[model samples]
Target: MPKPANDNTRFLVADVANLEAEIDALLGAFPDLQEDETLRADMLEGETSLQAVLTRLLGHEREAASMVTAIKKRADELDARKKRQERRQAAMRALMLRLMKAANLPKVPLTEATVSITKGRDSVEVLDEAALPARFLKVMKSPDKTLIGEALRAGKKVKGAAIKTGDDTLTVRAA
Candidate 1:
């Protein structure tokens, strides 16, 4: 039987924890095993085991990243398909509306549903926005992060904002 997707990850995590504990125990018992050859062999074996577990974990990480990429591509394809369907539906609705208007049928009764064309709500159409009075327009303002960062870097202090360094990120390379 095939294992679940997360089984390998769980097993690798458990292995790493166990290997760490074993290494710690070996270090604590070093004083008691003074000059014993088995202690050196055990430590070497533990180090090897830890390396293997870490390699497996890296492999799993790569697999997870690949899955995410594949899912994103599929999502894009699905979105494109949805948009095409929406356009087709809109065109069909427009055609039906035009035909109904030509036939002077404001409402059509069908077995499953009723189709009707009613007056839409009133809306304002602006031909020249700049010519509008101040009260009829809205003013929006926002802080520019790029400018803020530039000023901060130039040794200027900004109120309610300060330069903050983020934590280091890990990068993995495939061999």
Candidate 2:
């Protein structure tokens, strides 16, 4: 019998979940299985369903990773183009400023916009950091992860900190 769209979708989801749970159970049984030992398809209910599902999932993972790489490459290209445009605009502004200063004009009026030359605000410049007094310097402190990890690994207790072990990650590869 032909199923409705929603029913078909629900069935597929439940089926995949069941397949995953079966695989987990099979792996859990062989905690000390050696590399030479083979897990046959007969271990699962369906003959080759496990192999098919694993192949599909691995292919999807690789496709997603490729998409991310392409997106980052395009973003980098756009950023470089934007920076070049900014540098060009700055250069044009500097040329206009030089011309106005040479002609002794404080402001110039245009149909679209008005360009003006104004005195910049006063500011302090730091020449040498070592020569500065303690009052003028600022100190910042932060936790060191490397030292904390070492302490935890050596069985030393650190206040307000503890190491956590996460679930195993699956590595997808072409075979």
Candidate 3:
């Protein structure tokens, strides 16, 4: 299933925080002077209008703070979820290696396992000689469904076999 889009409030919160930080940083770097009449007019807009600005600024700051907290919380949750998936994939890879080792077959790296669903052929062959076993080498020379079916019928097993990664599906079934 597809995930829903994130809330738009997050961007607003981030913008508010950045604006606040910039305001503070500018004030600290260049202290205000009372020499300019325009500056004095804006600053001296006391009590009523200044109060409204203060109230709105406070609300924006609160929203920004809350958004930052929420983003951090979501990041931690995603990190945990990703770690769990990695561990599961690692476990499956280990199991596949063990199964192939037991079957007296050369260990096929996950990257080298180029899976395909061909209509005429049902067999698997390791093309790389360094990674290929003698039995698999013989299979590669003559690619046929009959040979593959006969091997499968005799209870011979292939390892790291699946229609897709982490599928746990057998090669015979795919065949």
The order of the candidates by lDDT, greatest first, is 1, 2, 3
lDDT of 3 at 168: 69
lDDT of 3: 0.58
Pitting candidate 2 against candidate 3, the one with the higher lDDT is 2
Clashes of each: 0, 0, 0
Residues 9-88, model 1: lDDT tens digits: 66776777788787677667676554676866666566547567767778777888999999999999999999999999
- The numbered model that scores best in lDDT is 1
lDDT by residue (112-167, candidate 2, tens digit) is 99989989999999999999999999998988989999999999999988999988
Residue pairs of candidate 2 with colliding backbone atoms? none
TM-score of 3: 0.38
Q: Rank the candidates by TM-score, best first.
A: 1, 2, 3
Which lDDT value does model 3 have at 47? Answer: 15
Candidate 3 vs. truth: CA RMSD?
25.5
